[model samples]
Target chain A: MTLSPIQILVIIAAVALGTMITRFLPFFLFPDNKKRPTFVIYLGKVLPYAVIGLLVVYCLREISFSSPAGWLPEGIAILCIAILHFWRENVLLSIGVGTAVYMLLVQYVF
Target chain B: MQSDNLHSPKKPADKRIKTKALKAAFPHTIPVLTGFAFLGIAYGLLMNSKGYGVGWTLLMSLFVFAGSAQYVAITFLTSVFNPLHALLMTLIINARHLFYGIAMLDRFKNTGRLKPYLIFALCDETFSVLCAKEPPAGVEKRWFMFFVALLNHTYWVAGSVTGALLGSTLSFNTKGLDFVLTALFVVIFIDQWKQQKNHAPALIGLLCSTLALVVFGADYFVIPAMIALLAGLALYRKRAEKGETL
Candidate 1:
C-alpha cells in the first residue's frame, strides 16, 4: 500500500490502456481497406484451437510430481473433464463436475 | 415465391431482434458467470487483503477487464512506483489478447458499434466463449456478441465489488477454489477439439506449450510457447493449404 489512491488508479488505468492496445492493435494494423496477408488469415483460423490447448497446460503450471498432492487431483480432474466432455458432450457438466472433483480431492483426500 | 419468402419474415423489428440476440447470448454466458465470479472474487479478496478498497477493485475490473493481467497489476501496485515497468509487464501479460484479436478478426467484421466494445472486452473467457460457440441461427451475430461481451464484463465487475466488500470483513477457507478457471479452459479445449475436423493445431499447441513449460519454466514460458505455436502452425499451413489435410 505504498502507492496513494491516485497512483493506484493510474496503475489500474495503465493496465487498462495497455490491455486495450493489444486488443485493438490488430484492427488498426489490418484495416478494412487493406488486405490481410494469407499467412495472417491462416493463423487466425487455426490459432484459437491451439491457444486453448496452451491455456490448459498454462493453468496447471504449478504442479510437480514431488509435491504432496503430486498430480493426482489435477490428473484425475482433467481426465474426468475430458471423459465427461466426450461422454456427455456438455461443457457445463464437464467443467462443473471436474472442478467439484478437484475441490473434493484437494480439500478432503489430498 | 421462395426468394420473396426468404427476405420477408426475417425482417423483424430492431428491438425484437436485439431482445432475441440478448436471450441467445445469455445462456452461452452462464459458464462464464460461474468462472468469472470465482476468479473475480479471488482477485478482489487479494486486493482487499493488500489494503486496496472496493472502489479501486471495481474501477480496475471496469476499465482493465483483463483478468490475469489485473491480478498481476495488484502485485505492481504494492511495489515501488514505475509506470514504464508496469506498462511493459501489463503488455507482456496481455499479449495473448493480440492473438485473440487476430483470431476474431473475421467473425468481428461488419459488427459496427459493437466491434469496438467487443475488442475492448475480449478477455480470455470472452474470446474462448465466442470463439467456440456461434449465435444460434436467426440471432443477429453482432448483438449476440455484444451481449456476450457485456454480460461477461458485468459478472466480473459485480463479483469483484462483492468480494472486495466481503473479503476484508470475512475470513474463510477458499483454497482450491481456483480450479474453476482450469476447468473452464479444459471444457473449452474439449469443445473446440470436438468441433474441429482437424486436431493438429490443437495438439501442436498442447505439445509445444508443454515443452516450453519444461524448458523455459512456467514464469517465462508463455511468449515462447506462442512463438513456437505460431511457427508450428505456419509450417502446417504449407501442408494444409495444399489439401494434404483439410
Candidate 2:
C-alpha cells in the first residue's frame, strides 16, 4: 500500500516473470528434439527424491525454536504419518490423518 | 479411408480416453485439493488483511500461481517498493521448479498442444502428484497429467477467490489447516524413500536444509541449502561413478 498501484503491478509482473523463467528454463535448455546430457538425465532421476526431501524441510523451516511447544506438534504428526503410510500404504489416509492430528494438536494441545 | 470415417470415430475415442484419464487423475489430486484450498484461502485472507481486494488475489493466484512467492510478495507490496528484490526472491523461492521440469521432461514429451499449459501449471503440488502417480491402464498419460495440473490450478484459483470474497466471514477454527502442505511433502518423501535404493540424496537434502536453516535462519536458508544440496549430489555422483554403494 505504500507504493503506487503501478509499482504494485510492476512488482507482481516481476514475480510472474521470475516464476515462469524457472518453470520454462529446463525445457528450453534440454528441448525434446535433442538428447539430454548424461548428467542432466542423472540429475532428473535423483533430483525428485532430493527435492521432495528439501520440500519437507522447507515446510518445517518456520518451526519456532523458542516456543514452549517447540517441535512437538510437527514431530508427532510426522511420526504418525510415516507409521500410517508404511502400514497402510495409502497416500490419502496418511496425509489426511496426519493433517487432522496436527490440526488438533495446534488447535488444542499445543 | 473416407474423410468422415477418419473424423467420426476419432472424436468419441478421444473423448473416452480423455474421460478415462480424468478419472484416473482425480484420485491423485484429492490431497492437493485439500492442501491448496487451505493455503490459497489463507493467502487470500492475508491479501485482504493487507487491504488488497479480491481482484488482486484472483490475479495473483491466476498469474503468479506460486504460493510461497506470492506470500513473500505480500511483504514486498507493503514495504518500500523494490521490484528487483521481488523478482529475485521469486526466482530463488521457485528455483525448485527447474528440477521438477527436468524430472518431467521425458514424460511431458510428445504431449503436443497440452505441453505448454502443463509446464505453466506445474506448481509444487502438481509436480508432486505428477511425479508420484502414473496413468492407469487404458488412460492416456498426457491427459492424466494435464488434468492433475489443471485441477490443482483450478483449486488454487477458486480457493483464493473464495477467501477474498469470504473475507473475515467464516467462523470455523481453521488455525492449523496449513499443515496440510507439510504433511503432503512428508508423505511424498516417504514414498520416494521406500521406492529408491539410494537414501543419500534424501539424507543430504534434509541435513543441508536443516544446517542452512540453523545457520542462516528461515528467511535466507533455501538458496544456501540448494547450493549445499548440489555439492552433496556432486559427491554422490563421484562415489557412484567409482562403483561405491550408497
Candidate 3:
C-alpha cells in the first residue's frame, strides 16, 4: 500500500491525537487534590502482569500444537525461558536461549 | 526526613542527585534502547520500501511517535486514506495508554512542565521506568524524565534516519527484526517477575490472558483481558493479605 501525502498526514495526525488523548488526560484533567480510588491503585499494580500475559498469548496465537512445527517446540521454549527467568533471574540468557531453541526447532526439529 | 537530610546535606546535593538519577534510569533503559533501535530501523526500512523517504520517517517519529501504531499507520496510509478508519485503528491500537496514564498519575503529579511531555512519551518502556520507583532526592525528576524520553527518541530517530538512507544497503534478512519487540517484553516480564516474591499475580496474568486470547482472538483480547485480570487480582488481594505472616 502506498499513501499519498495527504493520507499520510491524516494518519499521523490521528495517531498523534489518539496517543496524546490517552497519555495527557490524567495529567491535565485530574486536579492535584484528587485522590485515586482504591480500585485504581489495585489496577495499577496488577496491570503490568495483565499486559505481559496479553503479550505472551498474542505471540502464540498463530501457532498450533496440532501441527508438527507447532506448539510443542515453541511452548517448550517459552516454558524453559520462563523457568530460567523466574529461577535465575537472567533476562539476557533466557531470551538468548529461548530464541536459539526456537530457531533450532523451526529449522530442524519441528 | 533524617534519612533525606543525611543523603543531601549541602544545597540538597543536586549534583550527585542528577548522577544517581541517571544511574537508576540507565539499567532499566538499556533493553528499551536496544529494542527501539531495531524496531525503528525496521519501521524506516518499511516506510522507505513503501516509497516514503527520510522526511516522512522523521516527521512521523517526531509527531506520531507510537511505535507499533506508527507501523500499522504506514499500512493504513498506504492502503487507503479513510480518516475515520485511521482514527479508529489508532484508538484501538493505542487504547492501552489509558491504563498506562492511570498508572502514572501519582508519580507524575509533581513533575511540573515535564509532566505533559512525560505523559506524551509514556510508551510501554517509559512507563516501566517511571512506575518502577520514585526518583532519588536531589535529582530533578524532570531532568531524569527528560533524559529517558530524549534518549529513546534519539535512538528511534537515529535508527529511522539510518534505515531511510541505507534501506537497501543492508542485505541481511530482516524477517526476525520484529522479534526485538518480543525480546523486549520478555526482558520486562523477567524483570518484573524477579522483583516480587509472590509470583501469583504473574501466574494468574499468564493463565487468564492466554485463556482470554483463545476465546477472544489476539486483536480483541487485550482490553477485556486486562479488565478481567484486574478484577481477579482485586478479589485475590484479601487472600494475599491474610496469608502474609506479619
Candidate 4:
C-alpha cells in the first residue's frame, strides 16, 4: 500500500512523538539518587534474555512446520546454528553458515 | 567516616577510574557497529520497498533512529495514520526500553550534558554495552558511551543511505537477513549464560516466552511474555541469590 504525503508526515510525526515520550519517561520519573527497587533490578537482569527469547519465537511463528519438507531443513538449520554458536561462541560463522545452508535448502533441497 | 576523610583525594582517583572504564567499554563498539550496519540496511530496503526514496530514508534514520521501531513505523505509514494506534504500537514495541533505563540509572546518574543523548540512544545494542559492565576508573564513561552511540548511529545512517541509494537495482535474496538480530541475541545469551552459574533465569525466560508465543500469537505475545518472564525471574531470585552465596 502506498502512503500519501500528508499521511506519511502524520505517521512520521506520530512515531517520532511516541518514541520520544518512551525514551523521555525514565528521565522524568526517576531522579538520579533514587535507587531502583530490587524487583526492578531483577527485571533488568532477566529482561534481555526474555526479550530475545520472545523475538526468536516471533521469528519462527509463521514457518509452515506441518510438512517434513517444509519444516525439517529450517529446523535443522536453526539447530545447527544454535549448536555451533553454543559450541564455538562464534556468531558470524554460525549465522553465515546457517543462512547459506538455509538458502540452499529453500532453493534446492526442499 | 575516617575512611572518607582518608580518601579525600577522590578527584584524581575518580578520574583514573573513569578512564579505565572507558577503555574497557571501547571494544564493545565492534559488534554494535557491525550489527547496526546489517539491520539498518534491512530497514532501508523495507522503506525503499514501500516507495520511499533516499531522502526519506536518510531523514528518518537521522531523526527517528530507533532501529526496529523504524521498520514497524513503515507499516504504520502505509496504513491510515492513527495516533492512538501509533502510540500503542510504540509503547508495545519499545516497552523493553523501560528495563534498559532502569539498568542504566546508576551509570547515567553522574552524566551532565551527555545525559540527554545517552538516554535517547539507548537502543538494545547500546544497552547491551552499558549493561554489560561498570565503567572503569579514570575514563570519561560518558564519552565512551557517546562514542559507542555515535559509532552505531553512523553505521546505521551509512547503511540506510547506501541501501536506499542502491534501491532495487541490485536484487539479492534477503530472506535470512532478519536472523541477524537473532544471532546477536544468541551471542548475548551465551555470554550471559557463561558468566552466571545459574541458568535457571535464562531457561525460564526461554520457556515462558515460547509458551506465551504459542498462546498469544506473534502480534500480541511480546508484552505478555515479558511480563511472565519477569514475574517468573523475580519469584526465583532467592534461588539465584542462594546460588551466589554458596
Ten-residue region with minimum lDDT total, candidate 2 chain B: B1-10
**DockQ leaderboard ranking:** 1, 2, 3, 4
- Which candidate tops TM-score? 1
Q: lDDT for each of the candidates?
A: 0.86, 0.85, 0.71, 0.71
TM-score per model over all chains: 0.90, 0.87, 0.82, 0.83
Q: How many Å off is the CA of A8 in candidate 4? A: 1.4
TM-score ranking, high to low: 1, 2, 4, 3
- Give the distance in Å from residue B115's predicted Cα in candidate 4 to where it truly belongs: 1.4
Best by lDDT: 1
- lDDT, model 1: 0.86
Residue-by-residue lDDT tens digits, candidate 2, B1-246? 245332254687777877788889998888788778777887777787778879889889999888878888999999988899999999988988988999899989988778999999989889878877889887878889999988999999999888877776754666676687788789888888898777888888888788888999888888888888888888889988899644
Task: Give one digit per residue, the lDDT tens place, for model 4 in B1-246.
Answer: 335422354668755654564566667777766667677777777778778988788877877777767878887877775867976897787776776776677677767766888888777777776766555555666667876776677778898988877766867766666556655666666677777776776687788878877788768887888788777777687776777631
**B84-124: candidate 3 lDDT, tens digit per residue:** 78777777777777777776676676665566677778887
Clashes of 2: 0
Q: Model 2, stretches more than 4 Å misplaced?
A: A1-4, A64-67, A87-110, B1-10, B171-176, B244-246
For candidate 2, write residues A17-110 as lDDT tens digits: 9999999999999999998898788888777778887888888988886885778899999999999989998877887899889999999999
Ranking by lDDT: 1, 2, 4, 3
Which residue window of length 10 is worst by lDDT in model 4 chain B?
B1-10
Q: Estimate how well candidate 1 is docked, as a DockQ score.
A: 0.67
Off by over 4 Å in 3: A70-110, B1-24, B241-246
